[model samples]
Target: MDLATIWVTFTSWAGAYSWQVIVTLAIVGLYFLIDRLTIPVLSRSADNARLTESSGDRAVGLARLLTGTLCALAMMVVWGVQFGSVLVFAGTALTLLGVALFASWSILSNITAYFVILLHPTFRRGTFIRVLDADNYAEGYIADLGLFNLKLITENREAIVYPNNLLLGRPCVINPRDRLRGVGKLPPLPPLDVVPNNE
Candidate 1:
């Protein structure tokens, strides 16, 4: 072969190989960026959903819902339909499911925050609470003793939902004065004189 012809053939092959390498590198860079950033950001909504209940079923249930949602979203994205093909109805369904889960969590979290802030003054921290006209009596941690209601999680794993109206009428006491109240070592309540129920 002539010297010029050989040189031309080698240059053409090198140009093609360089283009392929550039495309490959771009794909790899995108994959790593999504894995490191996108997944974590998407998973955070789940954590925000579990805003209430320091140690009760509601909190645990929220956690489970959050985990399930993140897993489902990841699966859908990974298994999404390819270009030029119709998107599956299943993908839409999964997206709706994720939205619903997030909505419910947000509503519940807001309710908990509202209850805590409204009932703050009368409801001090570390106070053992008994709800009148209710089956729940929270007594472990004054997780958040608020104005509208007293948020207490008992040692037995039950959250006592005491309303502001009820707490306002009944007298109570507290033991601590901090933002975070740990479980156990709850202060005792003064003995109340309850008349026998003549039902």
Candidate 2:
């Protein structure tokens, strides 16, 4: 057809899908906006934990994955994908969620605790920490903060791998004024005092 015929047909098609185009653009803009606002914060957190500034990419990646999923779902609705198509996978998703809840609960908890540790102002890498336990004590410097577990290096250079959640559950004493924090020559930790349990 001539240019005039093409222009008329295109206008008609655009008029029919105008709402979808507007909603899709809005959804995409919102997705990028959320990522732009959140990624810098998460990236700073990751950067602090890792000295090289590379781990921050993981934060960016995770934010992209989650926001992409949310925006994709919104776009699907705007385009009027049938509910039957969505419901088809709901059963499999529910089954997998159930298994994760029961089987990988501890793993999930540790991952969550990693975020808590990053946010906790009092505890951090290089903080001289002593965990008071009933059986024994764990005394070391907060050598490395990680996603699932923390790596502690004692004054004697012994490594203690502790799960994230259990580390948060215990009472910890942090001595920021410790002169030998990085030298691996920490002074003797004070004896633990037993608090009487009322229960």
Candidate 3:
């Protein structure tokens, strides 16, 4: 088509969807502003709470994901996408995701627990803790709090990788200060005596 024809087509298209374009831009701009305003505040809160850098980063990432998802949904609505269709698509997607995640349910639980730990100042790195499991009790200094598991350096110089989900379920006694001075030196285990029966 000629330049004049192209100009006419463009103008018609723009005229038809001008409101949608404006609304989309506004939503995007609002998301950006929220991101800019909240990120620094989240970082500072994490720092003040003595949370790990990874925790702060994860929180920021979750926030960004939420903002982006909301903005996209808003834009889709503004562009006249039917809500029923959107709901059906979202439901199907979520169902598939749920099934996929079911096998690795612990991983999902751990991620959720990670956020909980990040928000609550309970189990941070460098704290001494005892997990109250009668059969499999563990006491150690927390070396690092990871998304899936926490690294615990036992008093006996043994490192235990404890799952975040398990950590949340079990009762724990926390010593805010490192008792071993950041060393993993444990008391000696009691000697086991073996007796043999001769027939």
**Overall local distance difference test of candidate 2:** 0.70
Could you give me the TM-score of model 2 versus the true structure? Answer: 0.67
Give per-model CA RMSD.
Answer: 13.7, 6.3, 8.4
Tens-place lDDT per residue, model 3, 121-144, is: 766667788775644567787777
Question: For residues 91-157, could you state the per-residue lDDT of candidate 1 as single tens digits?
Answer: 6765765564334343333434443333344433544444332322234454553323556677576
- Please, what is the TM-score per model? 0.25, 0.67, 0.67
Prediction-by-prediction clash tally: 7, 0, 3
Given candidate 1, what's the lDDT at residue 8? 97
Worst 10 residues of 2 by lDDT: 177-186
Candidate 3 clashing pairs, residues 3+ apart or interchain:
155-185, 155-186, 156-186
Regions more than 4 Å wrong, model 1: 1-27, 37-86, 89-94, 105-199
Looking at model 1, which ten-residue stretch has the lowest summed lDDT? 42-51
lDDT score for residue 117 of model 3 = 67
Decoy 1 TM-score against native? 0.25
Model 3 TM: 0.67
